[model samples]
Structures are given as structure tokens and as C-alpha cells.
Target chain A: MNEPYFREAEERFCELLKAYLPYEDAYQELYKTEVNNLPLYGYGVKGFTLSMIEAIMNITNNKGDLKLVEGALAIGREILGKPVELLEDVESTLKSLNGDYRLVMATKGDLLDQERKLLKSGLAKYFHHIEIMSNKNKEDFQKLINHLDCAPEEFMMVGNSLKSDILPVLQIGGNAVYVPYHITWEHEKIDHHITHDHFHQVETIKEILPFLKSQSYLTKETLK
Target chain B: MNEPYFREAEERFCELLKAYLPYEDAYQELYKTEVNNLPLYGYGVKGFTLSMIEAIMNITNNKGDLKLVEGALAIGREILGKPVELLEDVESTLKSLNGDYRLVMATKGDLLDQERKLLKSGLAKYFHHIEIMSNKNKEDFQKLINHLDCAPEEFMMVGNSLKSDILPVLQIGGNAVYVPYHITWEHEKIDHHITHDHFHQVETIKEILPFLKSQSYLTKETLK
Candidate 1:
């Protein structure tokens, strides 16, 4: 039930590093290198794979063993082959809200990866629009909303990441719902006390249904 | 005047193989390897870079030296750092069509790379929608038309690749204008005799202007 594939790749890297360094220290160093190489490689399995190779080069002092390169290739092949794992409530949430409100998927992901994942997730038909954003910044949200031809208040964003899907939307005056998954992406973990009229948090995607239904009711019946 | 950066990377890979094999032999082998890895790496600078490493491994019998990996790393870094080189008439073409047609960019490309290029290209202002498709198949075209709320005939695809941009669109009953870029992506080179009512081919992007203008004429004045 809990086989997150990226963790498998990370653990593989850690194991590869076991001969030279401690696990946590190696992980931190690897993460740092990946972050530093983000601009060059962008993101997704290919970038992750490339960063692993780069990290190996750094750790092994540019004399990275051929076997380690083999490991990196294996890691890349494994990650690329891994199937998309949709969150439990994601399909239900999309089904509930798809028709009533325009459902758009905005992701800062690899084009091939996200598109493949969308196909694999069996959730493509539920979305009115599927956008692969370069970054999830305030400007990106504003551009997305403007392109959608929807006002900020009328457009609501829902996702698991506060840093990406929440803050940027809120900053741009769009409504946002935070559906915290059990395992948050490390980069998206933020400690913020939010007290906004427009912001709401839920433990899972299913929990957001009530709030959305009521809010949409107000929008259709009251606002209209 | 033109330094297609990807070519530079290719040449570097070729040079690296000079010690072991003939130039053209090494080049063909690398090309074959890169094509094979397309499913694994997808299409992008990262994929190309990874394929080079894989090719090196293949060529060197998995006894690939550290210098080869270093060469691949440098190639990846160099390619990623290269700026967007907008075609000469692309801006002019968009400028001409922006007001009339609901211009949408449909690209089967790496999301981050395309987005970054779009931003740098500064032609983002012209497009009403930007779609990064996973593939350029007939079904992909149909889906895009459906999402755009337009009939296949109402949507016109303007692109350089005959394989990706022309055949698929024509197969889906969409209008297509092919502007042949001088440097055709090797994978997109297709020898097809296109004799269709909805297909038009031009040497340069600027040539598509008159066709599009006259098309919008038929769409607005004649048809409506």
C-alpha cells in the first residue's frame, strides 16, 4: 500500500553511498547537489536520474566507479518503468467536482512524465484542462487564471502542496484548498499559520468535498 | 550565425569516440543508441545527454571511463544553458495572427524546456493557449481540438515537422500549415506525398501568413 517509487531510488542511492559515507549525511549531500542541479536538469525521472549520476561523481571525487554508473542507469530505468499511483481520494474528488466546476490539472512536472501519469491514472477525462507549468509561482498561477478566463475569486485551486498549489494561488487572490497527503514532497513542506477567509485545509482530498460543495452552492445560488 | 547547441553535443560525443572508432561509425552508433533510449529517456536535452552516456557505455563495453561521464555531464550542462533561438519569422507570424485566430501552441516536448523556451522566446503574448502534448498522434490532435472547444476543421496546426505536425493533424481532419525549418529534427524527417484539401506547405513561417489571413477571411466573411 505504501510503495512510493522515488523512495526506492533514493534508498538505492544511499546504499550505493554506504561504502563511503553515513546514510543521512549522504542523503543530505545528494539532495543538496540535486537542488543545485535543478536549473540544469529541470525535474522528473530523467533529471532525478541525471542528478544521481552527478551526485555519484561528486561523492566519488569524479572517479565514480563504472558499477555506480550502472546503478544510476538501473535506477533511471526502474523509476521510468514505475506505474503512477493516484491518491485514494483523487478520483472521487475529481468525479464529484468535474462537471460542476471546470477541473484543470496544473503541474510543474516533466511533460512526458505528467502526461504519462495522467494517462495511467485514468483521470484524464475528468480534467477540462491539463497544464504542465514550468514553475508553480505566483505569476504562473496568475497567468493560468487569466488564460482560463476566470476571475481570481471564481477560480479555486486544490492540491497537496502548500508551497506550490496553495500559497501561489492565495497570493494571486484565487481560492485554494490544501489536501495534505500522508507523505508530503520534501520541498513542499512549509510551516505557516494561515488565517485567511479564502484558505482552507483538509486532512485528505475527500475531506474537502463538503467545503467545496457549500462554497459552490454560495457561488451559484447566493453570488449569482 | 547559427550554433544549434544539440549539434555541438553530438559532435563532442563523436570526438570522444575518435580514439576507438571511425567518426561516422561512432556517430551512427550513437544515433542508434539515442533512438533506442527515446522510450526510456523521452525527448529532450536530458534524454540526449543520458543516451550519450549509455552510448559511451555500449561503445566502451561498459568499461566507460570517468572522462566520458564527465564529457556527458558537460554536454548536458551546455545544452541546458543555451537560450531559446526563435525562428526569424516566428515572431512576425504570431504578430500577424494574434488578433484573428485563437492561436494555441501544441508541442510534444519537455514541459519545463518548452515553457522556459516560450518565456525566453517572448512570443507567449501571442498564444491564447499553450498545450504540451505527450505525443503527436491523431488521438492527441482530437483531444486538443476537443479541449479547445473547436471542431477538427476549425483548428489549424502550424508547425515544421511533417511526421509530428502534419500527418497527425491531417489524419484527424484538422487543417495544417507546414513551415519547413532548415534544420529538420532527424526523427521528424518523413517522405510523405501530402495531397489533401486541408494541408498547405510553405518554405518559411512568414509564407503561412497570407494563407492564415485568407483562412480567417473564409472563416469570418465567407462561412459566417
Candidate 2:
């Protein structure tokens, strides 16, 4: 993110909330309320945008301020229209791993928004296919692993979020390498530590190549 | 669904518009604007809700009226929360076809919204797994067919919308059965007649059972 990504959205949303609510932690309250709305709204810009509007309404005591709604809409449109930015070494790492391994993208979010990001990233061609899920739970991983015709032990997931991409995979007997982003979503933060035989934490995308190249990634070489 | 499906939502949105503007066809205007927003917002109630809010802003000259926003959210929530009502004979016909053929569900919409509907419909157990796409175009169908390990000519799709479900499948050399719904979305309405060897039209869900039972579904037994 280089200090300029979702944190940008959060700052803008905080600014929007501050214009209406007196509390300094008003934007944080939006997160708490959104966690409650996750089951109903799920993840994505649309859900987040809706949550912002709902929070605005709640904070204003249903006053329906025209200016606040307009500001919220503008913030949402900006986030939705933001271009996809690739992490450093992502393209090179994919290029290095492309010919030897079969790659698939398993993502969870608004269908169109996820597809749009993939399309704009220009990395869609490297994947065999895209697997879109409602949530990244144990069952979702099991179903996806089954559908891909692979055993859980043989399936490896490389993603940025430990909550969605790492813990569930570890719970289901799969391999997961967590590459934490600098500007992670607060909802994805975990208070506890993870210690598993199949879990590895890496500092960047390119570091996984050495273990993968050995074809025996189960070793304790990269465990943090 | 016989009388109280999406039409109810549309009527509610129209009522919302009538309160803010003097136009008799303001909800119709919502659909027109939504068509233009499809590329950005895609399908499902979330997209529809966003389009409604955007339409209100435009119609009100960016006034962003609080009442209209609340009304739009109410209508969107109603559609999102409404239980999935099975079509007549849907359960019985699916039961009859079970175990004899590999049943699959190919759907499109918001990721969580579609999952919610499938879970609510109690039809999730009937399919091998769900296939959710952003759209139902030829490319989407072709990719799904490829994923399912079936040839285009051997694959069959049974859906309600001609523009989305039938034409795209036929265009890609696949078989399709059209079962028209009573309250068809105007956006899904087609103006042309279809005459294809791979196409069949049925009035209800159970009507396809006869040809499907014979296993020679390509035979000219049920043209109408």
C-alpha cells in the first residue's frame, strides 16, 4: 500500500463521520456496527458503503442530512473506482511460478468488484480459474479443495489476511503462507498467535519461491 | 413469487419516487439509469439499491433527500430479506431428476445474496455445488462448462431469462430450456423469436421431465 490504500478510505470515512458525530472514535464505531452487519451485508465496497450510510443515519438520529449522504456517496465512488495496485514482486513471483504450478484464485467479495480488480490487475491470465466464495471458512475451503480435485494436505493458499486466508486453511489441514499487508483491515486482525505445523509467515511475496521450488514446502524452513 | 416478488420492490421504489418528484414514470427512469450503471454495479439487490439512490440524487439534483434514501434502503432490504419462494413443482421435479443426472446450479448475482437465497430456498442440497457469476453471458457459460468438465453441446441450462439464460447458451452451442416467469423484469424481456435445434420452451419446471427421462433430450418431442 505504501501508506496510500484502504487507510485512505478509512481516513476519508472518518472525516465524513466527524462532520456529523461529536465523538473522535466515530469511525471506529462504524467498524463495530459493520461487524454486526457482516452476516447481512458481507464484504465488499457496496457493503462498506451501505454501512457508512447506515452509520451516518444512526449518528444523525435519522435526520437524513443531504450533505452527509452526498459525502458518503462520493467517498464510496472514489473507493469503488480506485485502480487495482499490485504488491511489489507479485508479477515477478507469479511469472516465476507460472509454468511449474497450476494457479487458482480463491476470493470472497462482491462478485463484480472482485472481478473488476482481477481484470485491472492484468494477472487474470495467470490463473486457471477464479473461485468466488461468500466467506472463507473451513467448509468453504473444504468445498473448494474438493472441487479442485485436490486433497487438503496438497492444497496451498497464499494470501494476505490471516483470518480469512490462513486460519481456516490451517483448520482444514491445508497449507497457508501469510503475507501480511502493511494496511490491513481491522476486521481481519487476530489477537492471538498462530502456531501450526503447516502454517508459515513470510515478509514478502517472493520469499515463498524457495520453499515452493524445493517441492517440499512442509519443512520448518520458513516458519516465523 | 406468483404475485409478491420483485414487482413489489419496484412498486415500492416507484412510490418513493412519487413522493419526491412529480413524474409518473420515475421508477422506470431508475431502470434506465441502472442499465447504464450495470458495468459498474453489476446485478443483485445491492446494485439495484445503489442505482436507486443514485437515481434519486440525479432526479433531485443532488439534493440527496433523506426520505428517498430511507425508502430505497427499505425496498432493498425487503428484497434482500424476502424468503426464496419455490416455483410450483420445483421441489417435486428436482426430486424426480435426482440420482439420474448430475444436477448443478448456475446462478449470477451478489456473492452473499445468492448464497443466502440458495440456503433459504432449501434447494442447495439438490445441486452438486453452486456456480455464481457476475453475468450470464456466453463467456461466463463457456467458462462454467469448462469448469464442469462438459462439452458445450452436451451441457444444458434451464433458466427463466431469455436475454441472459437462453440466448447466450444457444450462441455458444449449448442446450437451453426457457421457463418464463410471470413477473419478468423488463430488462430481461426479449423482442425476437428463437428457432434453434438446441432450444426448448416449457411452461413450468416439471414439463422438461419427459424429454429428460428419455435421455434423448435432443429429440423433437417437446418443441413448444
Candidate 3:
């Protein structure tokens, strides 16, 4: 539930470039082209790393050295290898809700990378199912709901990104609780001006407990 | 069980390059580097396409044009979009084995692309489960076996590549039946000198039926 994904990537890119101008320029071009072209080029740490290297080369007006390319790729691999931090109170919240409802972790990324992270996270025991998605669009949410054999009104999603985690669920008639992460990827950010009966914005992951309690979404048996 | 995967990719590459020396040179270099670097770079259609584009640019002594890069990526996307043809007797063979044993389709590729091809293939109904793997190493097989809640000995893998489908299973103490495809990726090629009690090499998909029947692997209910 916690990922300063873009921030971490930018930090790594800046560290590799060691020049603010090139790093800034590369970041700008990468987000502009790569985000829009993700469906065409596909999405993952590997593609992002390659795109960043290409952007840096173009902005610096230098054909990059092979060794330098290897260095940048190493950063990509590092990003994949790094474990994502869980939001404070995430485990307790999951523990409280575990048997009351089926807890599932739904995230989008390279399958191997995500699977490796889950295995390393020490959070695998909390989830009934772990779904690593390629993309999180409305249709993907619909497919997941179908797979679960649950009515849209009975499904609830909680995550940091409005575009990916909230809007898709609301669109499919499912309840969604938005827990804003400290840092959000530009690709995942969107205007939150719309109104919906099933949507609520919260400051942190822990707030979802009281919100769900207020909404009668969870039974009192496990609330203790 | 039928895929001209490598052949088609090479044809597309040669057509784009229109020069044997560079094509051969790029292909050799790409396999040498990409395969060795797979654990770091990760594997999939997108990564392979990016590596090929980088390879071509190096061999041709030119920075790749954006349009040319797009064309090469289009080739990769094309491969992902192309559905593998089922061998002539595959449907009948699967139908016979359908009830006798659980059928699962395990393939390696980009997640979205593979899911798309599976949806388009009209062959999704034959398998009880579908696994889209990032790579076909023994560890990946071990993970699958763990997920399936079965021991290695209970598994039987049948596929086109000796490296991917057969050897990994054999190494893990699982039964493997190798049904060689007409065209195999050079990277997937390996010497088939090893033998085990559970290993069988068949000429085609139909031959597997008779072999399994003789071995008493299939229940008599289906063999009749």
C-alpha cells in the first residue's frame, strides 16, 4: 500500500546522471512520451530504465557508452530488487480485517518483480490472493470482479492512486477508499473532482478502518 | 505446442535490416548478451525488442531514428499479437486428456501480450489453469508447483522447447514430454543427451496420445 515509486526512480536517475539539467530534461521527456506510450511499449521497470537512458543520451547530445548503459540498467534492476515499504498500521489493519473479509493484494507491475517483492515483504500471510496485474483499467477491474463472483456493490478497493485504484472500482459500481500516498506517480494522478456514493478520500491507510466501520461494511464480530 | 517464434522474429529482423552481415551479427550478439543478462534486464517481448533495436543500431553504426525504433517495436508487438498455431491433432489430444489429468498452459512472455493472445486463441477452455511466466528456469517451475499444491512428481509438462519445457521439469523430478516444434528459437535450443524415466520425445502432438496410453499414464476411461 506504500510506494514512493516515482520519487525513488527519480532519485536513482539523478544519482546516475549526476547533472541536474540532464536529469531534469530526461525526466520531463520520459514522463511526457513514456506514460502516453505505455500501452504501446508496455509498462515495467525495465522499459522505464531503457527510456530514461535513451532520454539522457538525446538530451546530453552524446552517444552513451555501453558501460554507462549497463550502469543505468543496474539501477533498473535495483529498483526491481528493492522492497516496497508498507504504510504504518497496514499490518494491524489487515490483521483486524483478515477473517471478516477476503483480503487480497492487487498491484500492477512485472509479474516476477511483484511476486519477488511479495515473497520478501513478509506481508504474504495477510492476503487470501495476490494479483499482479499488467494494467489497472476499468475492464481489468470488471474482470477481477467477475473472477471473484461478487456483486459490484460488495467489492471495495483501497489504494493510493485515484486513476488506477479508485476510479476503476467506482466505475464498476464498487466501493473505493482512497489512501493518499506521500508520493504519487504522474501517470497515476488524476483530477478528483467527481462525486460518487461509493468513493471516499482518506489521509492514511488506518482511516479506512473507521470509515468502513461507519459504513457498516464490516461486521462487529472481528472489529474487536 | 506449435510456435515458429524465433524464425518469425528473425525473418522480421532480416527484412528490416536487408543485410545479412548486420542481421547475423546483431542476432548473435543479442542472444549472447541478452540471455546472459536476462536475470538483470528481465525477459519478455518488450525487453527483447528493445535489445534488438539497440543491437541493430550498434551494428549499423547509426543512432536509431525514432520512426525506425517504432517500426522495430511494432515488430515485437506483432509477435505478441500473433497467435501460435495449434498442431493439427492438439485439440483432440487435449480433449482425450482433459478429464484424465488436469491441463495447464504455461508460457513465457510479456504479461498483457500473452493474455491478449490467449483471449484471441479460442483455446483457453482446454486448460484448467494458465501460467504466463517471465522465464522458464527451474525456480519458476518450483514456484508453479508450489502454487498448484502438488509435488514435482505429480506434474507432467509437454511443450516445444527442450530448454524451457522439458529440462526444467526433469531437473525438478517431474515428468516431461518433449514435442519439438518445427521452428525453435536459437536461444531455446540445447542438446538433448540426458535421459530420465519420465522423459519421452515425441514427433508430434498426436504421438503423445499413443505414448501416454502405452505408458498407462492416462486413465482407461479416457483411453477407451
Q: What C-alpha RMSD separates each model from the true structure?
A: 3.0, 3.6, 4.7
Fnat scores for every prediction? 0.61, 0.43, 0.28
* Comparing 2 and 3 on TM-score, the stronger one: 2
TM-score of predicted structure 1? 0.90
TM-score of each: 0.90, 0.91, 0.79
Chain A TM-score compared with the true chain A, each model in order: 0.91, 0.91, 0.87
Residues B1-224, model 3: lDDT tens digits: 32466466756776676553556665676676567656655667767766666665565555444444445666776776666675688888888778777788899866776777777767788887788887799998998888777678778888888898999998998888888667777778886575789899988888877787687654443222
Tens digits of per-residue lDDT, candidate 2, B1-224, equal: 32255677777777777766665568667878788888877888777887787788877776656867888877887788887888889999888776765678888778898888888889888787588889999999998888777777777789888999999999999899999887788788899999998888999889989857554644333221
**Candidate No. with top lDDT:** 2
TM-score of chain A of 2: 0.91
lDDT agreement of model 1 with the native: 0.77
Ten residues in a row with the worst lDDT in model 3 chain B? B215-224
Tens-place lDDT per residue, model 1, A1-224, is: 12367777788899988887789877887788877877766668788888888888878887767778878888888877777777777788778876676778898656777677777889989987777787888998988877777788877788878888888888988888887666665666788777788899888788766876677533642221
Q: What DockQ was computed for model 3? A: 0.30
- Count of clashing pairs, candidate 3: 0
Candidate 3 ranges with C-alpha deviation above 4 Å? A1-29, A50-78, A81-83, A149-154, A192-194, A220-224, B1-26, B53-78, B81-84, B95-101, B149-154, B171-173, B220-224
- TM-score, candidate 2, is 0.91
Cα deviation in Å at residue B155, candidate 3? 3.2
